[model samples]
Target: MIQIKDLHKSYKMGSNSLHVLKGINFNVEEGELVSIMGSSGSGKSTLLNILGMLDEADEGSYTLDGVPIKNLNERVAAKYRNKFLGFIFQSFNLINYKSALDNVALPLYYQKMPRKERMDRAFHYLEKVGLAEWSHHLPSELSGGQKQRVAIARALASDPKVLLADEPTGALDSKTSHEVMELIQGINDEGKTILIVTHEPDIAQMTKRIVNLKDGIIIDDHKVEQIRASQYV
Candidate 1:
C-alpha cells in the first residue's frame, strides 16, 4: 500500500546541511501493522513526516496506494493527505474548548460532510474506541488514555486508508499505554494499514513488524510473533 525507494532528506543549518534520512528503502503492505523504531536523531520522525506527506523528501521516490508523491502542488497534496491519511500524535492535538464528540467530528466537518452524517460517523468511531460515554467530556476532564482514545476516534472518523501514529503511547502510564495499544491492535485486525513510530520496545513488539532505523537508514526489518497488547491491558 505504501512504497519508498532510495529516500533521502536533509535540512540546511546556515552553511551546513544536516542529513536526516539516507538511502532509505521501505514498503508497507495493505492491512499490515508496522512500527518504525529508532533512537534520537535516527530519522524516524523524518521518515514519518515524509510518509504522512507533511514534508517532502529531498530525493527518491514515494508512492502511496500507487500515486507518485513527488512535486505535487500544495492543494493537490492536501487533497491526497486528507483522502488517504489519518494521524495520531502523542500530544492528543485536540482543541481545549471542544468536547470529545466535537473533536472527533472536526475532520469530517473539514471534508464538508453534512452535519448529521459527520456526527453519526464521529459517534460511531467514538464507540469503536470505547469512548461513546465520554463524548461530552472535555480533554481536560478525561484521563490520558481517554484523550488518546478520543484522538484515535478522530483519526478514524475520516475513514482514511492509512493510520500513522507518532509516539502513540509515549505519555501514558504502562497500563494506559497497553490499553491504547490494545485499541490500536484491534483497529489493525479490521484491516486498517497502520504505522507506528515509537522508541519503546514493548510498544514496537505490539506491532506485527518492526523496522529499526539507525544513522538515517533501516538497519533491520522483520516480522515477529505478535504480542497482543490485551495481555498487559
Candidate 2:
C-alpha cells in the first residue's frame, strides 16, 4: 500500500546541512503489520512524519497506494492525509476538553459529514476499541490504556487504509502496552496496514516484521513468526 524509494530529507542549519533521512527505501503491503526501530536521531520519527505527510521529504519518491505525493502542495497533502492516513502520536494528541467520541469525530468534520453519520461512525469505532461505555468521558478522565484506546479509535474512525503510529506504547506500563499491541495486531488482522515506530525490541517483536533504522537509513529487516493469537505467552 505504500512505497518509498531513495527518500532524502535534510535541513539547513546555518552553514551545515543536517540530514534526517538518507535515501531510505521501503515498501509496506496491504494488511501488513510493520515496525521501525531506532535510537534517538536515527530518523524513524522523521520517516514516520514523512510517511504521514506531516513533514515533507526534501528529495526522492513517495507513492501511496499509487498516487505520487512527492510534490503535493500543503493543502492537497492535508486533504490526502485526512482521507487516507491515520496517525497516532507518542503524546496521544487528544483534545483535553473533548469527549472521546468527539475527539474521534473531529477528523470527519472537514468532510462535512452529516452529524448523525459522523456520530455513528465515531461511536462504532469507540466500541471497537472497547471504549463504548466511556465515549462521553474526557481524556483526563481516562487511564493510560483507555486514552490510547481512544487514540486508536480516533485513528480508525476514518476507516484509513494505513495507520501510522509513533511510539504508541511509550506511555503505558508493560501489561497495558501488551493490550494496546493486541489491539493494533487485531487491526492488522482485520486488514488495516499498520506501521509503528518503537524503540523497544520486545514491542517490535510483536509485529509481523521489524526494520531497524540507523543514521537515517534502514539497517536491518527481518520477518518474525506471525502472531497466532493476541497473547505473546
Candidate 3:
C-alpha cells in the first residue's frame, strides 16, 4: 500500500558529498510482511525514516494509500502518520517513569479518544503481548523483553495500517529476540502490513520476504516460502 520511485537522499560531509540512496524503487503491499536487510551504512534505516514520514528524500515520489505524501504540510503529514503508521525502534523509547499502560495509551491522546477507551484498548494489546499484569509497572521495573512488549503495545494502540520497525530486536538477548519476532509475526498474520529493517539474517527470515540492499540500491529480494520449499527436496 506504499510506493516509492527514484528515491534519493544525500548528505554533505566536511569535504565530500555522501549519497546514501540512489534511484530506489519499491512497493510494499497490504497484508504483507517485508524485511530490508543490509550491513551498516546501507541506508536501511534511512529508508524506513522516509517511509515513516520522519524524514524526506531529496527527490522522489512517495504516495501512501493512493495519496501523494511528498508535499503534504507538516501538520497534515503528522496527522496522517499518526493515523496510518506505527513505529518500533531498537531503543525501547519508553518514558522511564510512566507505567506500561500509560505508555501504550500515549498515542491515543493524539486521537483525542476518551481516556477510558484508550486505556481499554491499551490493556487489550498489552495483555495480547503477555503484559497484562505488568500494566502498572514502570519501565525500570520490567525486563528488556517486557519493555519491548510495552513498546509494541504502544505501537498497536494506534491501530495503524502499517508498522515499521528498525532493528527491533537489536538490544534484546537471543531468546527475547525470538519472542519479540513471534509477536511481530502474529501481528502480520492478522493482516497488518509490516516492514522491518534488520541486519540479522534470522530476523529477516521471519518475514514473508527479504530484500537485501547495498550502496543504497536493492540487490536481492527473496520469498521465504520459496526458499524454504526448495530446501525440502
**Which of the numbered candidates is closest to the native, going by highest TM-score?**
1
1-233 per-residue lDDT for model 1 (tens digits): 99999999999999999999999999999999999999999999999999988899999999999999999888888889889999999999999999999999998988999999999999999999998899999999999999999999999999999999999999999999999999999999999999999999999999999999998999999998999999986
Question: Candidate 1: lDDT of 227?
Answer: 96
lDDT of each: 0.95, 0.90, 0.89
Off by over 4 Å in 1: none
How close is every model to the real structure, measured as TM-score? 0.98, 0.96, 0.94
Q: What TM-score does structure 1 among the candidates reach?
A: 0.98
Locate the minimum summed-lDDT window of 10 residues in model 2.
224-233
Give the RMSD in angstroms, all C-alphas superposed, for model 1: 0.7
TM-score of 2: 0.96
Candidate 3: regions farther than 4 A off: 226-233
Better of 2 and 3 by TM-score: 2
Q: Which 10-residue window in model 1 sums to the lowest lDDT?
A: 72-81
**How do the residues 1-233 of candidate 2 rate in per-residue lDDT, one tens digit apiece?**
99999999998999999998999999998988999999999999889889898888888899998988867788999899988999887789999999999999998887789999999999999999999999999999999999999999999988887999999999988888888998988888899999999998888888999999999999998899865335752
User: Candidate 3: lDDT of 18?
Assistant: 98
Q: For candidate 3, write residues 45-151 as lDDT tens digits.
A: 88888899988899988888887787777898889999989989899899998999999999998899999999999999999999999999999999998999899
Candidate 2 colliding pairs: none
